[model samples]
Target: MYQLKTKETENSVIEFIENVEQPKKREDAYRLLDIFSETTGYPAKMWGPSIIGFGSYHYKYATGHEGDAPLVGFSPRKAKISLYFATGDTAREALLEQLGKHTAGKGCVYINKVADINEDILKELIQQSVQFLKETYPAEE
Candidate 1:
């Protein structure tokens, strides 16, 4: 059984951002906190030690692996800020094309700063991620 390293914690998101070493990264973190919160319509939560996440959905894979993950999240790493969005969403690729300056990884998008990308497109990615996850892994009511 594989355990996920990044699980949601009770840590304060603001506190985490304040502790970020780089002044620019710290400032960007705060800006991202607001953007993610307003865009997702859900409050921010600390995921693992660094990721600031909003909204969550449980997923079970065909191989029987199951876990809960945030619908969208970001981490202000020293090298680059990582944006976490739904990998299954086809629209993500199209949005990223218009997302300005950013690098896409296997599961995360890396940006130097928020200004390097379009906030409106970022919000769309967040919205589409949440919608795709909810639809793909519909929560049990």
Candidate 2:
């Protein structure tokens, strides 16, 4: 399971954001924090070294692979902001097309900056991803 040592990581995330020399990037991180909180209705917390996460869920597969993960999260990376949607292959081509300028990896969306994307579309993407994850994994007690 991916257990988060929240106390240690939370301060790290805050400091990391605070030290971002680019004023625009720093502001974007704060904006993303608010967007994530509003979308998840859960307070933001750091997950591991860099990710700002919200909520959590447990998953167990038939193959005995099981773990707990943040419901949704993002990390501010040097080249781009990595948005963790946890819906790697769920056919979101339509959303991606409308998401403005961004690239994606197997399980994450990489945006150079919030200014480079449509905020409304990004919010919809986040909301849809959260809904998809909830339905796919459903939380386990």
The top-ranked prediction according to TM-score is 1
The TM-score values for the models, in the order shown, are 0.97, 0.85
Q: After superposition, how far is residue 60 of candidate 2 from its true place, in Å?
A: 1.6
Can you tell me which runs of candidate 2 are displaced by over 4 Å?
Answer: 1-13, 88-91
For model 1, how does the per-residue alpha-carbon lDDT over 1-141 read when each residue is reduced to its tens digit?
688988999999999999999999999999999999998899999989989999899999999999988999999999999999999677999999999999999899999998899999999999999999999999998
Best by lDDT: 1
- Looking at model 1, residue 110 earns an lDDT score of 99
What lDDT does candidate 1 reach at residue 113? Answer: 95
